[model samples]
Target: MKQSLTLSWLLAVAFFAHSQSFNNLPVNTQKPPLHGRHWMAITGKPLAATAGAMIFTKGGNAVDASCAMLAATCTMWDVLSWGGETQALIYNPKTKKVIAINALGVAPTGATPEFFKGKGMKYPPEYGPLAAVTPGTPGGLMVMLAEFGTMSLKEVLAPAMQMAEGYPIEAQTANSIERGKEQIKQWKYSTKVFLPHLGEKREAPNAGEIFVQKDLLETLKKLVEAEQEALKKGKNRKEAIYAAYDRFYKGDIAKEFARGCQEQGGLITEQDLANWKVKIEEPLMTTYKGIEVYKLQQWTQGPAMLQTLNILENFDLKSMGYNSTRYIHTLYQAMNLAFADRDFYYGDPAFPPDEPIKGLLSKEYAKERAKLINPDRNDPNAKPGDPYPFEGKTNPYLTLLEKWGTAHLHKPTSQNPLDENFLEEFAAGTTSVEAADKEGWVVSITPSGGWVPACIAGNTGIGMSQRMQSFVLDEKENPFNVVAPGKRPRVTLTPSMALKDGKPFLSFAKQAGDEQDQLLIQFFLNMVEFNMTVQEACEAPSFKTYQMYSSFGKHEKAVGSLTLNSEMPAWIRKELSRMGYKITYQDRTSGPINAIYFDWENGSFWGGSSNHGEDYGIGW
Candidate 1:
């Protein structure tokens, strides 16, 4: 009888152990997932996430925490700088609405197609002052903090300000500086800040070495002083923050910024600074299987995801099997179709030649586009379709579209070879920030442009944006996106949010240039369709297609090429190759995707930071 009791006990113990296992999903992940009850902060760097946690601990909302994270990452030079542009999507709990922040900078004065053509360029230069747009991130940060945050600008910027004074540099940024020393030496102010030991064997700061930027510290202080003075003059919180914004765009700071830009051979004027404003606009949304997905409007490549989702909705993706050859082919073809439309039809809404966003997002248009998918093999010659007809307008650029389709032939523009890593320079990756609170505030941001090898704009200690290269030189390539002074470029910086049952469902963003929407689409589906946990979904093997034109340098494309996770089965690779795919393998195809999933059943937050990069997350 004692032996029988022991057997029963062992069975019970085994059952309990199985039930207690937290990760019940089939997939294994390199990193453990994060769970939080009150708040969650995730960003590209560890210090940046810590900065967000500091704001959350101070009783600030998600917007405040996100702004703090953004500032800190920019200060750390995590693929960006203070002068980079910011694109964000914020979920305001009070209004129960999602809002898009269009903080992308516009082409400065004298920036035009003719101007670029005169410089003997196919498109804008990839780097240097001539490639810069007017600074937008400073204005973006102040506006987001003032409009939605409960904390003051001074409070939100505390962590970044401290870092600007001096902080131990991480290996990533330090090594990037070392590798780009030659480029850094070309710019006097950049050399002054990035190379502390200019004449040493390693000109850049060593890992863990203290790196300081006195000019940036002083510039931040000047903005704070303006805000404080405004408060003393009886200004409201929002007004006081705007006071700082005014100082940056129209006051002494603007004078220095414009002068420094021109001194570096850029075209920005003080009037350009004053004229540039932060636009808080309505976001575009499309419902995917009862969940409402939101993305910034036409100026960004975000709508392409919506279009891809729309096309994909017609197929039964779940039955095709996860990571199966058929599934990969479907997604690749759908993305190519959507991105082809994006390459031609997307641009700034505030400019002329209005984008047919209405027709592009129409269900009928999606259905028509979906029918074009060749089930047997890849369609390297897939071209943009007529979206205008769905919106009741005749297609005005049909002729250009036809000629462009035949002329491109899925190849890079005929340009001189690059000295840098062509793929990395083509992607021009950035960093992302994700934050959320139990109070219902959610923020998703993808800010980019001024990376290492960036040119610094004089004593302002700000790196100039390299975003002007995103503009097309010829109207036939993308008529709506042709470079013009005061027009925003068609950028790849896309931040995404989702809502279900009238509440926040997921807040996610990533850092790859033209591949942003592609990676995001897979990440979102990994959870919603495959039933994987957030972290599993984040680290899951994903494939990349280069059938669409790149949004960065040379606007290149390689027809029939696909990058799959290196661990993909040999049989799967053979099958894909048989279908006419030029397969390349990478150990990690999931680029730093940071996300927050709302655990409505538990009334908490689940955060996911991919294991591949230095992306980190904290929950409390």
Candidate 2:
């Protein structure tokens, strides 16, 4: 309690130093902002957002509506599938506290560093059954709906079940299927479902064509049947939901999943499913100018945002001028420093060799890290700092850190963000979900894995998670993140929320791999520092740094790499390039940020869906 008070005092001082406000400007956004008096639902796909809207219309709270959106997006394969993982932050109006949902899957049996090394691989494969972790979305959805939501499973899943029966395939998904047909063909069940037009020139479903997943529909029906049976036995709503959850993880669904996984050279077993459980935990938080910002623990990269905020607290970011050379460099340097620590220290807390989360979030520690920044140029060699000392301990991995530094210094630098491979690996898979209702319930979620070209788990119509690729085999890379059975990888998925004056203030998330935190940090600053509305912040031109190791595909990093929006002024780009930075340009560097701002004064909600992708929102 003393430590908390001290930290709060330090943050308060920092906030006061930079409390001057910027002028609110009239801005034109590509997409109009959404205003609502009752509810708001936004996500990666139009149809999925509609699904949430449907639930809200039926009088469901934000949790139930969010569950519906998650289901519909997974069902539509909006860069995710049923066999993927879920990570969420929910604000409960009754408790006035934020709760974190850790539904991320874990490495299955026989999935060890030595096992993958024996396969002549440095890291786990990016695709196929061998890359699978046990599925978590089904269990996660069930737990959330049962505990916080008022609706039954049948009602929440109705839209997704209808989608499973048949829905018009969108161009994005259809094209993705066509592009990945070769990999899809490698898995028999995947080929059967994704390549319905097999032997034809296209081989995949066409946009606007009715795509059907009979097996998936049947799978949904089975879950409903389990819930119905449990209710008939006099079970409560929550108990009935758990019955369905049991059927998915321990009964016929589990059997088929294990059988199909084994058939495809995967490591998942029925035991893995039964042993897996979704954890509802107290989230980590930090105060940025009196706004309480929350993020999941270190098992994810979420805390890096908290760390970044801590470092930025030292600078007068608002006075630095938004998107100015000074602002960009400061934010980039802070992000790199935070991410450097994230790469080395973060992992599943359930594993051994605990992370120094205490020292990492220390305001004093952030000040120490802030001293390492160079005011003139990008630090191509920013290395992880020692947080153990701040926590009253010594770093046991000093030798490893030295060796890691040497290896990183020798890595080749890439100036090209246009490299198709880099972009593909960087953006990767995932989708965001944001919802809020008049009842004061707000939810932010970033769910991913089991995307297109997924390996189907037999006749269950469930795709196996490819999250194992996030694990590193070499301890020199990240000692805490080395692959081991039953351990969760340090994932890139992060959801964000902020509360001001003990009330819901903001709920936001995006669909990008390692860039999620970096982009989100800018989004928050745009609103608070520059006085931009939520919609303007969503569509704002942002910059990205690739200085940290990616969580996917060979785990590579790029030193001094910066991707700026094409709309950025020529003068700013020129100044940035002169500062020892590798500058690249893209028209849409914002990614697909979706956010909901609570208009407490107006007693309403404001929704922002980025124009960068197919993300959409509905409000009423």
Candidate 3:
């Protein structure tokens, strides 16, 4: 008889403490210190990072541990999984070089803007042409292990496969599962894994319930066995790794994926799958107060960091006072300038020409742009000023809504105040890892994709990013965010690393769409200028203004007022209001932010996670 999973999965609230013991191990002490050889830090759900730490302790290198973490996260935290893209910035102390792995997938070749228009779709359709993309997490992880790791695929995948086959669903995981249940029911494949038997009458599996993904485990096993066989043939590590990629992208697995896409209205094709290759590009680098900062390129909002940093360079942030009106206004002005440029120029570089980064980051350009800020009064209808000569030549790409003809450039009005009141609720999510050896090599990887309605396919378990929602509708533009062939959608996943005295001082990452770059800038400033500890820097209350989306579009610029976390002083809010700034106080809870800061003088590691998440910063 099939086991009755109902009773086994139902967990009582009183048992929460016990559940946490298994799931929420103390972040700092969960992993025993690694001797002189290696030390690593990971931020995600407590259980998932612990699983990865175990692999590293058992002689696995960074790549081995990262892959293991990815697989386990897929099963344990389906909200963020392997079916999504994994962008990373890895530094090799031996070579003293930084290599970026662009595991982000592309829109399938079969996709076109017209596909969505033909479907009579508008901005946010449940799921159709807009949702299709080449899932890249698996492809990216496999490549990293094959090229840089010391363990085989089988060993790296063992823990995750075993967990998926039989592992208890903790309360946290169960909560996410329950929260996303409605969306999961919308997709056949997602329902099969998350809501297996009950169909429309499905319910969430409770804590202590054994949540299993038999299909995902079997898929992992195939890749593991294939990787081992390749290694047995006396093939070098690199060749064995390539075999793993072939097994997925160009091998039998590709055929299965292609068939699934075809049946589901997904745009992926055999040619798209076979032609896909992860890109290796130099990260956008800049200097802030003699310290070097690096971020992913234009394919993401990575360059916004440079623009913000450039603007802040002109001001003495130290003297502005923390969270003060002057401080917040300056930051907002800098952000607005950066965001304005982002709207006009940021897009897939592979697309037609856009403004080059050099002009955007030019010192003169930032100075010219910074002059536009008026400290006493808010520029209610601020737009991107002509900082660079080319800024004038580039016309704002217009997005057309289905009914609305063309988006009109409207000045700021009471209809859309800079601080329009919306729901002030708290929400958070995760995924970040930091590792460094005594040799000075460091790796920081932040993997992210939205939760629900955007889950990865069965066995693949990759969560497709819903990042395309940020694209605005242009007037007369039939459908907005229409998935086009070779168009890289705007991404929220930005990983950052900072070097102090020619060594890795701080490796930080977080998961908030437009907030990613903004938060990074605040944290970096907190540390470098204000001289705060990692925990203090992150713990400090913050606020953000979302005036525009950083993708190509010409929508009425709506300035959403500053939403300050409650922890911020009331005086700060009053000061902001006095400056003609709209203030919306909100619950300050934020997504998990993980960081590993090296104490060069002490020769030790210090790590911390956002208090809002159930993650611990594990390091030794």
Candidate 4:
């Protein structure tokens, strides 16, 4: 019900924002992309930003600050649930090492292709307990703190607990609740928690109305209690932190998760919960103009960004002119190629039929793939390239995307066909947080899973993830994304870190799904090629292609669909249209981005946020 109304509401809100920013941005003193001296933190909410800043002032490092911010934001944004998925990339300057955390949960012990194939489910249901996997956000956050944070779990989570206990949610969050009001009704516990006092249904809260989630507060407190009890029993802080992690994945919470899944006809079992563990691996690195860009391994769309950058290096972007017809066309072609490779090759490492990261990231493969681009007109299709010998082995395509029959692969009137407005609403919203300390310890994390479709694990008041839906039911020829027990679906929740001359240069993250890497590429170019500031790069107009199959529901591919930000010049818009590119302009499709960069020349730290989602950044 609220999603239906959000389009009109968001438009009103966006119009006011654009109007104000447009009038004052060029000379807007007290502008966005705020800077800090010794440190900086940027998050989706100002309150969450404060939580991180408070941790930093308390002598905590970037890892500590990130935990605090993420926990607080989960409290503030209904779109960010404690039981959601999380992926983070952390860089430690002293060790000169970067660790990638894959906190995304796996398919349940019983989630095989049998049920989905027999049921003829082209896509799984969006809102329900049956759609969920074991929740992982709580576990992931604890692991991060235990390994890299200076603060204890209890100390870091104080802010979030306080908010859940009692606080007034303003207009923005209230709108999100309104958006998912109907979905909340679809689940038993979700409705009980969100609409407890509202009689038959949930009503949107007005600004300044006192809001409370006592159950959620209790859930958070239980984790703290478990940790404190372990400490009392002679366990050190780190052991106690691990105790909390074990409690979430192997103890009482895990039991409840299994019980809820069983009752919901879901595939998860207690064993799956106990067996689930997040992986902390070294980053997958690729070079771009002498800088080392790092991303998560095969399970994410991270390499697609690397692939896009490699292809674009073959073209002189500055000479083509930024946002020009040729520039946009070239970008579209490169992105489509990368995405084709992504759909054909990318998959979970623990699962077979996944892409070979080493082969895909090789410069030689990029050089080979660069030859596929056409200069004059848009080609509304994606023909995947060979990424074999690079990965040590090869698997032929399950079904050629080109043979799918239409130049426009999207079926607008098909079941569950999503218009742009509905598509945005269905985005399974993701949030990003970034923190950097004077020691050069930097972390970028994208955490998400909300209550809209997922259940609150049986009275635990923690939302669960519908991440299992990210997999495909391809049983025969495709291996990249086929469903099976214990497989991690190909996720779009990728964070990035980079080095310039072997020194930490940039740490950033964004909230878009498959479109994330595309936006990240454009943001980097805005800075390197155009010499724009961190703030300028974030605020610059951006574009993305939907020509590649999306990572979410039904794997829909809107071929040749080019979505540009409304802020672009009119001439460029017309020029793009003239080239037969299926173009549409609205607010950003890649969503809001946030970053913290080191200004080497000035010997200062600079920070910026897209601020499109009411984000905030602080540096000091």
Q: Pick the candidate with the highest lDDT.
A: 2
**Number of residue pairs clashing in candidate 2, backbone atoms closer than 3 angstroms, sequence gap of 3 or more or interchain:** 0
Return whichever of 1 and 4 wins on TM-score.
1
Between prediction 1 and prediction 2, the one with superior lDDT is 2
What are the per-residue Cα lDDT tens digits for candidate 1 across 492-571?
99999999999999999999898789999999987887676888778877899878887877777778888888667666
Model 1 RMSD in angstroms: 6.0
Candidate 3 regions exceeding 4 Å error are 1-38, 124-130, 197-202, 387-430, 455-483, 550-560, 589-591
lDDT tens digits, residues 1-620, model 4? 43543343344224333342222223221235677778898988888888899899999999999999999888775466887788999997778888899898887776777777677776554556656766778878998999888899998999898888877887777766666678777667777666544553447566667778777887788899999999999999999999888877788877877776667666677788888897888778888889888999878888888888888888878666556667778888988888777776778887665466777777888888888787876777556777777677753653564354243256555344347643553354678999998887899998877545446667777777867767777632146778777888777788888889988888888886776888888888767765667886786667877777766665667766677766555666787777766666676443588888987777677887873677777789
lDDT of each: 0.89, 0.90, 0.64, 0.75
Specify the poorest-scoring 10-residue window by lDDT in model 2.
8-17
For model 3, where is the 10-residue window of minimal lDDT? 5-14
Q: Give all candidate RMSDs, comma-separated.
A: 6.0, 6.6, 9.2, 5.6
TM-score of 1: 0.95
Q: Rank the candidates by TM-score, best first.
A: 2, 1, 4, 3
Q: Candidate 4 local accuracy as lDDT?
A: 0.75
lDDT of 3: 0.64
Clashes of each: 0, 0, 14, 2
TM-score of each: 0.95, 0.96, 0.84, 0.91
List the candidate numbers ranked by lDDT, top first.
2, 1, 4, 3
Q: What would the per-residue lDDT of candidate 3 be over residues 75-115, giving only the tens digit for each residue?
A: 57645665667788877677766778787777767455455
